[model samples]
Target: MQVNTSNDVKIYNLSAGRSQPAWISERKRRQMERADVNLRRRIQLIQDFEMPEVSQGIKVSPDGQYVMASGAYKPRMRCYDTAEMSMKFERCTDSEIVRFLILSEDYSKMICLQNDRYVEFHAQYGKYYRIRIPRFGRDMVYQPELCHLNLVGASNEVYRLNLEEGKFMESLQSSFATEINSCDINPLHQLLMTGSSNGYVEAWDPRSGKSEGVISCDIPDLISNGSGLSVTKLKFRDALNLAVGTSTGHILLYDIRSPKPYYIKDHNYSLPIKAIEFILEGDLIASMDSKILKLWERETGKPVTSIEPGTDLNDLCIVPDSGLIFMANEAPKILSYFVPSLGPAPKWCAFLDSLTEELEETAESAIYDDYKFLTADELDKLGLSDLIGTNLLRAYMHGFFVDARLYKKAKSIVEPFNYEDYRSHKIKEKLQAEQSESRVKVDKLPKVNTALAKKFLEASTNMDGKAKKKARMVDGNPLEDARFGDLFKNPAFEIDPTTEEYRLINPLVSKIEKRRKAKESHAEEEDVEKGEKEEPTELPDLEENGRRGEQEGSSDSSDDDREWVAERRKVHRTIRDEEYMERQTRRARKLLMVDPNRRGKVTEVETGTVPLISGRGVNKANVKPLGARLDEEEKQRGGAEEVQLAGGNRQMTFSLQSKGYERGREASAKHAMERKSVHRSSRGIGTKIKKPWKGKK
Candidate 1:
């Protein structure tokens, strides 16, 4: 019964007349303009149709091309075209169509229950059949996939009627003891859900004739008369969500996987819901007693809007593809409204229109607070903290900060502060600080020039006086000095491919070869000395050999003494025998072994005699070998070849036939390919002329 009052209130009071102030008139003009802007964007009445009779049910076709309605009192039905807005067909029968009409997918045929006793079917053009039923059907649903019409009877029984055969197949007994009031089928999942009068809802698998699950509505709040509330309507919003409407005006939504409903809502009018449906976008629409239609956003459980058409609505239908709502009532007029799909508006043009009153209230509050400043916390609560300094002032001056100037200013302030770069820089600084703290610093020492020290060491180490004098005489020769100086000046710097390779004089080569020979001679002499040191000695030392022999004799005597003592113990220990000792350990309880022939046997009365035996047996001489006995038993049991022959023969025959078939197919394929190749060769130029030379001649 709750309705949106947006249409009842006015923004400005223009009725203050011509004597009102200028500001009042201006305000009234603005309000009128705003109202004019919003009227075209919202839900609005498009057209209405006058029913020829009292309509009991209204439904739109799946393709949204036709609207069908069945009359309440008379057995009459009519179909209308949605695009053309004209009646396509109409028919009247001997029995009333009742409150339900099911149409085939192609709309070529229709079926309806008549007086809970018979079902009337109508085909294209004009063909009809009335079939009798054993039980009174309270509710019926048609499953297109199975091509069957499922009926729930007053006796809590479910029956399937084949549409093509036009006969009742059989009945499935429900577990519920009370009568079922409503039933629906989920075409996608092929499931049947039935609701009983005692608020028990059970999902049935028609194929198995067994209940899939049962939903208990026995909660204390939803129960009445020491039982559960009556289920007036049961509908599936989708394959997974079920919407159950009760006579108490409570709509409970349950997920098929759980026992409890995830959402519950009350209409508050306490009237039986006539029809419940979910639109293509998942919003719920419910109409009760034809007085009001409620639209709810399924996720929020909040009413989007409520429309009162001033008539008792009996049924509702929505054309999902066209976004149009159709409602039928007791009144002759059938109302239709066109509403756009619900979502965020592409352009919210009515922003100022919605905020005029809110702005006025805030202005009044501001005057009382004397324009006090808002703290940082308060600004954050208002979600304006990002607009800290100049940006906040700009928003106040411009009424709202949507201008390009404000956007650029804010972007300039935020563009330089990238979170990743700041974090990386802080990490680098932390690592450097930690490394500095872990290591100790000391003053650096100056380097010493080693060129003079190197020359002094060389002069002192190579003090061959006679060799130096001869080298000085050789250096006196201009040719020799020039050659020797070039080689010795920088023997390491031999060649630079870019510059040294193009030199005019090559004195460094000969001097370098002489120095190389001298180095080789020195290396050869050092190797000879190492070989002599590595050679083994040819003679042994007498004193060392004498000491080694004395040590070996002393060790051998100690080993001999220990061996004698061990031998003596082995010889004497046999005379001292000791009893074997057993250690006890904890284990599970067990009984000790008992002798089988502990009591003496009686020999007075010869009941049995043994021929010759060393064991306990009455007829020991006649005992047979185990192997011979097992061989005799095997002869009686026989082989398993007979049991396995049937299966093995069939398998071998199948494999042989399959192999032969494959070989035949391959042979045929080879013959076909050979014929094709011969045909192509005969058509070629080489084969076209039987004798090329003869044809030319």
Candidate 2:
């Protein structure tokens, strides 16, 4: 194995000895500053708790004092106290809880709908009672004033359970064609509403069990050319306002008095919405699907923000009037998200604000978090080779690190110019300019300039005389007005050079006078120099002879001949002797005539030619000609040639009338006719008899 001698690991000094480079410290400082700013601008996860199993449902209690969730693995329910931030109690049920509700604000009583068509009730300590319904329950809501518990499930009916009587009451039959999916009760008016799988929300009077009105939740634009949509969730902010979530990831807010929706919001995931709630006093609406959670404006339907938890979301509950939201998902832990802009943190977690503020003031991200460190060679691949020595690259150990934004900017700068984009941009600008220029503009004179306007009108009406011309001149030139006559008069004050103030101001006047005199003297000297002539210098005799020789050499030559000689001299000066000779040889070979049909065949005229200067020291006479060598090789091979037949058979044929041809043919015939005799050895094994040698001996 080969060992690496180069030190690839960097050692940083821990003590304050100034061992690190200045840029490293500077980069660290800048990263710390950036992280501090980002902390204050984004949402943060403050705390979390692990559950025994995957949480199926989660919700904050009505009094905002505790969080309750139900999960599997013996099918238990766990409640966490928000103030203490710990589990208050856990109770195991006979089956898994599909949905649950906290009936009392003091966390004394709770109701859970199990998957086995059973309704389980619990007090502050443990399980109190259980009741099995007719069908599997999907959702439930409790009305405090009527003391009635309403549950909707897989059937087209709403089952009512009176908590005061502790028994099942008369069930309300929904007139929907499909199964009921969700239901809600209006807080102010106590009106019952049930959402069906057929995309209809039916509001009923609970006292009479009669349908009051039906609202169609299907959006034609969303459901066009698609299957029918189902209502997954329904929330009522007050007596009149209602929010409906559909299977196609749409949230429709409506005023119950009108048939149309007030505004429509889409989750954009195309998944069934699991939960919808009105937070921040009904100003913002939060909707969730299995994929994403979104908070958007209720009045305008503009999206506020969204978060993807990278897991399947089961349910989410917002703390009463606050921004804190607790989510139950497929994971074993519940997640909480805080949106500071929506509302303040709950009083139980008020310390979170101070903790985040401290982090914003002191915490820092990693030094190379958002920067890409690259060497000079790596930068060349990105076309940033020209920026190696520039300040845009921060110098690190043996390379440089640039901000992500700066890297993108530099890469774009070095990119080739896009001529098509430039041309199109210019064309668009030209069109806009042409449209602007063709548009007519109306300019109105100020009402305060009535006198000037009157003069202008009079000048236009009387344009046939000198009086009119005078008026026109007065109207065109504002300075010709009588009120501006004093403005053009000369000032009364004049500078007196004999005074002390003038002397002080003009202190540099003597220097200016000296410069003028020197300039005049310099001009006179230049004129004197122009009038004189200098004597010529004599050339050396050798240089004169060389010049005369060049003149005589070109005197007898024509222009073309002279140009050819000069070009040849330039060529000789540029190339070595060997290269020049090779080029001349190539040119001479090209000039020779040859037949294309004779390709790969040697001709008599092209045989036995020796180069004048072969690098090897072999004598030219010792090198045999090509034809002579071929004849000698044929004699050594017994003048016989093998010809391949079409079916891969080989046939040997003798050459005609060649020296040693008869002897080679006889030897080949003898070898083909000779046969070895098979004999039995002493051990009774068969063996081949050895043939006698056919050599001279």
Candidate 3:
């Protein structure tokens, strides 16, 4: 014998009625007030009533006074008053409630079809009567006018039980070989509608026990896999409209007169649909799979709304004429959802409408709720380090929050490498490199002297015979052409005396000398402007005869004067020759330096060995000096003669000596003599001479 145990049963009272006792504690009162406020919110989960085990089914009575739910562990049904929203009573049964129906508004009479193929009837007090059926019942429906209970299960026939007679009655038999999964009765015509495992929905008349019509549902076309077309639920809005839920997560509505479905809705998850019902006076149809709850328009086949519960959903029932829906799931608690747009809250929770209004006015949703925040390191790992400072990532306190879609896209892009793309990119780079190398490139021209080129062009175009003759006459040279005359004649082509180029070439003329010359010129101009005049002094004159006699008497003094004049002439000549030689040497050095092959190969030649004539044979005023002869010789030799150094590849020159050349030559000669002496000593030390026979000597 099995002992009845109620130890595991639990009851929770979640009501927040306005009528509270004065003796209630402050905390309890505050809690009730908070619950009342939450219930007023538009669309929210208002209640979570726990059960002993997973709830099988839940429903609100026709009068909307109480909600009844059946569960396992104790195989009991609990009824919660709608006004108080608390468990009013619990009824324990021998078998678990598989499917249940409330017969009256008071919920005093209920018919529970158990999983053990038992049909149980209970009154307000307890289980009144129980009977066994041939097959396990999957679903059941009741007809009050006939006092009959119709059930369908694994068998091809639906079992009927007469409640008033309290005995078994004739079963409704279907001609199809498929087992019936669910059954419902049409209210207007009182015709029985049954959905079968073979995707057939058939309507039958109870009086005649004959088939009225049949719908194939074409389950293979509705699902991609083309399997599991067994209808799991059937709900009727009236005599003509019927809703069917299939095992393939499809909800099909049909008109009993037509075989094809009116509108078919997909739950998308493809889980077997658990329950379906028409709510709000048949304006909307509610369907549930194991994953979500969906409500859709009756006329338009568009989805009205949907809810994804935290747990797997087993059954759903919408409160009569209200948006509030109670859901039984694979958890100990029954979840309730409210949709304000579908309908208002029930009268018991009338404050929900006002609370939703207040919430809409004040509630603020967080902007980052849809974003995922990551730090710098995490971003680097995702190859999104470049987005650190970009607008795609919004900066929070320590990291950034990027849009979820963007993050997903970035992760996908950075995760894998395509070898084809890499190969193509490398090939493109190689082609570009080859093209760059093979393509001919031209050097950019240096900036042009526009004025000079233009003048040359103009002169060449307009040259006349007279201009050519005049240019030739100026120098009597072939290079003195009229087209090239401007190059020599134009002051713009000449180097300015005050410029750095002129100063570098003429190192003898110091800046102080230039300044002194400028001052002298300025003073002379001032004198000329002032019209200054100066008095001239008259020179004393001596007779020719008297000067001759004086010279004869003072011969020594005359000789001294002649010697002084000769010395002055010699010194002046030396200075002029040195300057000319220096200029020639510089020109030669520059020429040798420009030739790459003869660079650093030069020798200095002293041209000062020629004796000076003391103004004896040559006319002092008319004859050109030796310096002029040297200048012409240098020009004829093309600046200087090439001379190789004594050592291999050494730089030497045969150009004329410059200033400080004598000191450099003396130092080099001294170094050479010392080196020669050192070499002789080293040779002497390394060798030995032997004397014959006279060792002592």
Expressed as tens digits, the lDDT of each residue in 1-697 for candidate 1 is 0112333422221011111112225666466446653322222112224454466677866655667877744557777765655677777767766555647654577777776588777777764777777777767888877788887767778778887676677777777647887889886788899888777899988788788899976567864445457787888877898888887777888998999998887887777666788765656555454467777767778776666656677778766544445677774446554333332211211232333233221101111111224445544444556666553333332243333444444445655576887899999999997676443322221122233223323333343557557656443222224543443345453444334232222234434455566776888899998887866577778899999999997886677557556655653453232211111211111112332122221111112333444566555424655455435434543431112234332211011133577899999999999998877443467665676355554
User: Candidate 2, residues 120-236: lDDT per residue as tens digits?
Assistant: 888977789889899888999999988999999899889999989888888888776378999999888889999999888998898998888888887788784489989999988
Off by over 4 Å in 3: 1-48, 280-282, 358-697
Off by over 4 Å in 1: 1-48, 223-228, 282-290, 341-697
Candidate 3 lDDT over 1-697, as tens digits, reads 0011122311111121123323346786577667765324323223335466688789888888888898866788888886776688887788788899999877888888899999887888887878889998888999888898888999899888887887778877888737998888888879988889988888888887788888887656776885657788888887678888888888888887888887888888878888887775548787888888777778886666677655788888878777667788776667665566667778988876655434432222223333677888889888888877777777765788787788878777876676887899999999998676444332321123334444434443344558757655443232335765555566566545554445344433343455556776898798897787555476546587689878885895566557556655665666677779999999987875663323233534333434545666864422545566556545654556556667665434455454487889999999999998877345765457765686675
Any idea what lDDT model 3 has? 0.70
Candidate 1, number of clashes? 2
lDDT against the true structure, per candidate, is: 0.58, 0.70, 0.70
What is candidate 3's TM-score against the reference?
0.46
**TM-score-based ranking:** 3, 2, 1
List per-candidate RMSD values in Å: 40.5, 38.8, 39.1
CA lDDT, candidate 1, residue 48:
25
Clashing pairs in 3: 40-352, 600-651, 601-652, 602-652, 602-653, 603-652, 603-653, 603-654
